[model samples]
Target chain A: MADIQLERVRKMFGKVLAVADVSLHIKEGEFMVLLGPSGCGKTTLLRCLAGLERVDGGQVIIGGDDVTDHPPGKRGIGMVFQSYAVFPHMTVFDNIAFGLQMQRVSSAEIQRRVGEGAELLQIQQLLARYPAQLSGGQRQRVAVARAIVMRPRVLLMDEPLSNLDALLRLQMRGELKRLHHEVRSTTVYVTHDQVEALSLGDRIAVMKDGTIVQLDIPDRVYDLPATRFVGSFIGSPPMNFLEGTIRSSNGARALETAGVRLEFHGVPARGRDAVLIGIRPEHIAVERVAVAGGIPAGAIPAAVVVVEPIGPQKLLTVQVGPSTLKVTTPVDFAVDQGQRVWLRFDPSRIRLMDPQTGDAIAS
Target chain B: MTVAEQRLEQTLPPVRRQAVDWLPYVLLLPTVVFLAVFFVYPMLQAFVLSFRSPEGAITLRYFQAMLKDTYFAGALRNSFLLTAIIIPLQVVLALVIALLINTRFQGHPWFLFICAIPLGISDLGAGLIWSSFFTERGYLNLILQNLGLINEPITFLSFERPAWLYGAIVATEVWRATAIVMVILVAGLQLIPKDYFETADVFGASSWRKLRYVTLPLLRPALQTALIIRTILAFQLFATVIVMAGRIVPVLAGEAYFQYGLLRNVNIASAYAVLIMTLSMTITIFYLWLLRTKEEELGRG
Candidate 1:
């Protein structure tokens, strides 16, 4: 296995920059996920790493070699495409054996390795079947088997699970994680689905407009996003942003927005008049009745606008004055639309973001 | 199916089975009538004319006479030789042209347009155009002499050089017909998804390997079609051979034309027509057998 280093790799399609000057170093045997929405250059970056797209500027060093000018075949990488791309003309056995055949491996060795890979993927029974006879999930497994059988230095996957149905995708995702744990090969997976990224990647690099905005472990990416965009893009129901003005009085700093005032601590909102308070849906606790004291110290009274049941949890869209906020509650919680509730924000979990630049304010 | 649906189906009569069957036949009636009057009738008449004696008794006199003719063996040999040389050469050239166009480089549309120009020209027109260059004291000789490659002008279509006459006819046929095959192959290439090539590249396949293992295998149906069409057309090669070589290269179709037009013998001409038709059908069957697609092979298995 080999680590990959991309140094200021830039690619352009006409005048539009598909991949900007993005530099990232993936450790040997680490599974790195390039996560972003469509047109965000994550796929382009993966293509550059695969040597499929030539970088207009900078270097791509794999292992210890500066292989910036190498063709895809010579780069020692195996890629699983988004469409699975299992060669329809060949049987599953041939598809898995293609790379080995291209490498001119010995017949006996090819057979042994193909058998090992098929057994690993649980596709031994499908060796004689063509791609037309395989279902989408089966095709995906065949594609994975095809790539991993090569035993390449780097394995690149471009949204390989996007085409499968939800249940199949989940099952395949677990199988992929188990496979990676067993093989420990350096893999670069590109996908727009955050759930896949969060579950599969050792480190998720959130990209936007051809440049990576944040690179960190999944937990860090979820707990503390680097920017407002990252914070909003990562969580389900997303993070609720409330426009509030920072007020400093008598050595205590507090954020006052609408008629609700929540005091903040350890938040350095220096030189900013207003800040965007970001809070995840699950972090806020809602009280149906007023507390003994009018409201808790950091509680904001709000009326629920909509209640959506999501399996075991209830997502309540509560309006705090003119601004709307999504609050996650237990499914058994008795709360309805038009019901007034007091929202208690976990003070430590509150994030302050810069409205001007969409950057998260340092706490 | 659900029990209710099965019960409904059992309770109801099959819907309009006769009318649906009769509708398709009624729609096909015009085409069947047209073929009967224009194709089957003439084919039967020709078969009768070729075999029957003048006294209304069945005889093989016309076939025996045609076989005994001095030019018949030479014509048959020339026809087989020309077809064997032309079909393979045209297919290879057409595949190359189709692949070049598939690259989609700048001005490829214009390149395809230029390559297809000969397709618009009739076989006779192409023959005439090339014959002008192959003639004695023609542009070919002039250019050779001007370049000092030859001191004397060559008579390319001379009867003494049957090989030269054969070469000229082969060149004319190749130029006139390769475009149609290229068009068919190009359409077939487009139907193949680009992902296969990309996957091949990722798997470390070289350009030649990609062509052999992927492009060619996937292109079987189109290749089968092109070979059959080109082979059938090669057997019927007439106007171009007549235009380029005249009597110097005696092909089967040329013999038929000579027998019917110059000698005023319709029976011998009918024999030649039947021979040409048999040859075309036989070659078509051979191609169909040789290039059976993977699906067809699998189905047979």
Candidate 2:
């Protein structure tokens, strides 16, 4: 319902800076997620937007009004905590009605809003039950109902699905997506799980060490990561980094490592001695022999160390010289440990990074 | 082996296994005997004495006498009134103070130590210390006079000013008993997860609403425990009342002591003791019943 913007926001707890010089703009009705590891300041940023935490440096503008100093109640934002902090004493009905009651809504209006929230969440049957009486998934739905019942301008969730079991987490994630579609309220969700961020967020902001490393759509963040940290953090088996030096071979630019040389024909000349090459596991192809004219680029002969069978695919841990890389192959592929295999790297997928600064080198 | 042959083989005794089997009860015998002699016997004796009369006849004279006497009735009334006033007040005050101290305050450790100091002091010592301040020419009156608040010292211990005199003693007792409740409530407050408060804030709850809806409900167990403990201690308000009011406000325990030691009426003294014990048990049971109801609700939830 409202656009939330943070301009150079910073939060400091004494000497340690929790959120350091961050800026983000979330449009109305967008489901934006702050994704990062623990202590990466994702939660802090969410809290700042919710007005639960004070920003030490910058302004939080909501609906074209600066509301950095406003308390959470006056800011008109609803939040669901990770622990499902539904009021233990209050029944489901009371918990959902708390925000309306605080605003001094009339009894009829309060009941109507609460009824609608419960119906939207499909938790009308759980109205009389206390928080402790509900299952983990039930409590989560109740927490969601409690937040949405207020019909605030923005809704914030702090890892709401983390507490549920795997099956329940998947179920709740789908339900949350559906709820967002129906309500279409501006939302800011925080979580450490990259998969959840990719699945739930309309726009995902990946954070690291108190700063936003990258922010874009889920596919763009995953495939076109701007930084090495973002690339490494987003994928499941994670991106592999190989330390190498840039060299010219037969007038073609190539990256030379201990056991492999990867040539790039389309890459622009970057006059550097050392650079790190990054490639996702799925991009690297495993074959029986080094094939001719395969991208005319990077290829390595490595010994497989471990093979993990994951139903549809097999994740192979291959050792090239002293460096180990993981590659996803078909489960039916007959690959054994200690078996010598050739890995083909797609030249376009190979990202070059500066060794010293860890920044991506433009091709 | 045949059945007879196996039976013969099993008939052989094992000394070490027998000793091991008997070892646990042997270790527990001393504690069992100690409790039987010191605790069980006295309680049984008290129960039996409540039914005995002066002529050693099985009579309800003691109960009738306690019910009939105005002094006895007054003592019971004072006890109930003190409990009714003190328990809730102390529990609520302790909860607020505990919340204050639970913050990230600079001098929190020092404040906690000060709160716990009264608990270490004996009840009699606390009574004596308060009496020194409340006496006719005590430090309180001296301070008041020095401050030009009063022209002459007020006799706080005088029996003529019945209500005011009794009220001062009750205040002293509250001051002495409040620290225990504070300690218990503080422990309880610490156990509530900080995330709950944060969640309440996200729900747009004010500070007062947070306390009423989230805090007080979670604190029920601690509040109940503190109330029951304070109420039971209120009935034993002998040392403080005696030190402050002397013979003016006779609580049940004080009257029992007076009947036994000063009057040398063993029958009546025994009757008073039985009556006090009965009152203590009844009040304790009532509080326990209330606690049980809350606990059942918690279980249902």
Candidate 3:
């Protein structure tokens, strides 16, 4: 296993710059994921690291060696493509053994490695089957087996689970985590799914427009996103952003939007003007009774527009005024649509961003 | 009259359902009729004529005559020999050229246009062009004489050596047909996802190994299609061979034409045509079976 570092890497396709001046250092045996929306150049960056694409101007240093000009075969990196690109003509056994065979390993050794890889992937029974005969998930496993059989210094996965069904994707996600733990190989996985990035990555790099906006542990990225874009993109039922102007009211700073005024206890001095306030749905709490001291210190009164019961939790789409906010509450609360409720917003969970720049306002 | 009309309307099916059910057949009727008259009728006529005798007696005399004739035997042997040499050579050459064209190179369209030129040219035109160089007072003999390689012009297409005549015809035919195979193979090469090759590279596969393990295996369907089509066309090899070798080496088709047009023997000519058709069909079916077996093996792999 090896640590990979990209120094000021850039990729240009004709006049369009796909990846621009990006620098990242992935530590040894770390599972670093590049995550973003489509056309964000995350996959392009992964391809550049795999040597499938040449960087316009940069050095790719792997395990202390500068491999900028090296071909993919010499880079000691195995890759599983999004399409599962398993050779349609070869059996699963031959597919897994392809790398070893290319290395001119003995027949017995090839059989051993392929057998081991198939067993590791739990696809031992599918050894004689071609890719066309395998289901989507099975084909993906074979693709992974083919990559891992080589035992390269690093494993690069380009959205390998994207082709599988929902249930299979979830199962494969767990399998991938387990595989990473067992192998402890330095892996660079690329995906646009923020959920996968959050759940699977040791370090998640949130990217936008060919640039890395934030790179941190999953929880850190979710809890304290560096930018507004990172805050909005990394969460499920994503963080809501409200346009408001920060104002000082009675020795306290507050944000006033079109139909509501929310007092901010810890308002950043830099966001004294127009700012975007972000709050995750899970942070807001709903209660049936307005008990004395029931609402949090900084809370707002709102009317629930719609209540969607999602098994264990109730997702309440609440409207403070013209603006709508989603609040997740326990299912036992029994809140109905059009019911009045007090929303308790945790000031600690509030994220402030510069309206123009979309950067986090320093507190 | 009004009561009778109402009864008739009740007996008729729904207009929408009838249109939906009959529309497809109505659209297909013209094409079916066209094929029946143009293809099936002519084929049946050829088959019936092949069995008739010169004196209008039902006899196997023409078939027996074909089996015994030295000229017929030579034509069959020459056709097979030319097919065996030309088809494989053309396929391999086309594959290489297709690979070269498939690369991300400048002037790719121009190269493709140039390659497709021979495909647009008629076989007879191609043969005539090549014959100019092979003639005694042609460019090849002139160059050889100037280089002092030979004292006199060598007759490359005359009856002196029928093998050279047949060889020249095969070469010209290959030149005319290779472009088609190249176009098909090029499209097949494009269907292969780039990631497959990248994966191979990641495994440190050598160029030869990649070609053997990745390229050739993926090219099976295209190769099969090319082979069947080329084989069928090779059986009908007429204008090019006739233009190059004339009567010295008559392929089956040319001989069939000769028997009908020169000898005025319709029975023998029809028999030859039937034999050619049967041979083409058998070869096509044999190749299709081989392809099916390969597909089954692939499926079971």
TM accuracy, model 1: 0.91
Q: Fnat of candidate 3, please?
A: 0.67
Backbone Cα, N, C clashes tallied per candidate: 0, 0, 1
Q: What would the DockQ be for model 3?
A: 0.52
User: Candidate 1, B146: how far from true, in Å?
Assistant: 1.2
List the lowest-lDDT window of 10 residues for candidate 3 chain A.
A289-298
lDDT of 2 by residue, B51-86 (tens): 776577787776676667667877877777777777
lDDT tens digits by residue: candidate 1, A272-293: 8788888898889998664555
TM-score of each: 0.91, 0.91, 0.91
Off-target runs (Cα >4 Å) in candidate 3 are: A248-265, A269-271, A287-297, B1-31, B54-58, B141-154, B161-163, B293-301
Candidate 2 Cα RMSD after full superposition onto the native fold (Å) = 4.2
* Model 3 Cα lDDT, one tens digit per residue, A140-247: 999999899889899999999998889999999999999999888999999988889988999999989889999999998998888889987888778877777777
Model 2 residue A168 CA deviation in Å: 1.1
Q: State each candidate's chain A TM-score.
A: 0.97, 0.95, 0.93
The superposed Cα distance between candidate 2 and the true structure at residue A36, in angstroms, equals: 1.3
TM-scores for chain B, listed for all candidates: 0.89, 0.83, 0.86
